[model samples]
Target chain A: EPEVTQTPSHQVTQMGQEVILRCVPISNHLYFYWYRQILGQKVEFLVSFYNNEISEKSEIFDDQFSVERPDGSNFTLKIRSTKLEDSAMYFCASRGGRYNEQFFGPGTRLTVL
Target chain B: TQLLEQSPQFLSIQEGENLTVYCNSSSVFSSLQWYRQEPGEGPVLLVTVVTGGEVKKLKRLTFQFGDARKDSSLHITAAQPGDTGLYLCAEARRGGATNKLIFGTGTLLAVQP
Candidate 1:
């Protein structure tokens, strides 16, 4: 089955540096989302994108976070400045339509030093 | 914000045992989904329940949505060591342009041989 794919399975970056996590959602899926899981914590929603714009975002998705569909296949989350608290497993998901199943990617582990 | 609470954060059982994990919330959802995540991997969707009091079964696992649409449960029968993983319950919020999911804290199950 086709699945969402993410690049840079793991990344280590210095605090205050910028990092972009990339994802390629299922080709036919329209709705895309980003979520994060702190070590031993619940997975938290970050943002959702559809129709080439952000549809929803959580408080955690503050000024530092931005998402884009720079190309037909790539969806990326950019953090302007990384922080220790930003270290987590970031996941990308997509769904084709309302009430359709959302598929998830393997996730990218971000570590801030 | 909608919050989902899962019970018994950790469970360890012998092989062939049965267990149930729950997801509860005060807010109603249009749909609820269950996912399983192994170490170092992202969550994989197990099932999605859309209607109130709906039930669906997959192999040895059964899922039930609450009558009020605010809760759900996952029951695993004759669980094996392969069932060891983090189980998450996520709710699809109602009346939104985007189908963003609110995830529960998750239950870590360890099935030992």
Candidate 2:
């Protein structure tokens, strides 16, 4: 089965540095999203992108965060200035067809020190 | 913002035992989806419940959407050790032509052999 895939499975970065997480959603899927889960906490929505623009974003998706569909096949999330609280597992998801379920990537674990 | 609360943050059960996990929300959702996530991985979609009073089953797992569309449940019959994972429920929050998921608190289950 086709699955969402993310690169750099684990990343360790210092605070105030920039980090970019990459994801390749399933081919032919349109809607895309970025979410984060602090260890042992709920998965929190950061932003959603469609039609080359942001569709929805939560408070967590502040100026420090940005998402881009850099190309037809790659979606990227960039953290301009990482903070200690930014340490978390970031997941990328895509939905297609009826939009009943959103497929997720393996996730990029970001650890900020 | 919609918040989904899950019961029994952690559960450890013996193999072949049956258990139910829950997802509740104060706001209504057009659809609720259940996902299973293993350590170091993103969540995998398990089921989606769209209509009120809807029930859907997949193999040993059964899912139900409450009549009010504000809650859902997952019941596993004779669960095996392979059923161990963190379970999360989510729904797309309506926004300007975009759909983004808001997830539940999550339930971690460990089925012991």
lDDT to native, each model:
0.91, 0.91
Q: Which docking band does candidate 2 fall into?
A: high
Q: What is the lDDT of residue A76 in candidate 2?
A: 98
Kindly report which residue stretches of model 2 are placed more than 4 angstroms away from their true locations once superposed. Answer: none
Error of 1 at B13 (Å): 0.3
DockQ top scorer: 2
Q: What is the DockQ of candidate 1?
A: 0.75
lDDT of 2 by residue, B1-113 (tens): 56799988999999999999999999888988899999989999988889999999999999999999988999999999999999999887778777788888899999999
Off by over 4 Å in 1: none
Per-candidate TM-scores read 0.95, 0.95
| TM-score winner | 2
Give lDDT tens digits, candidate 2, residues A36-86: 999988888898888999988988899999999988999999999999999
Residues B1-113, candidate 1: write the lDDT tens digits: 67899987999999999999999998887889999999878999999898999999999999999999999999999999999999999887633588777788899999999
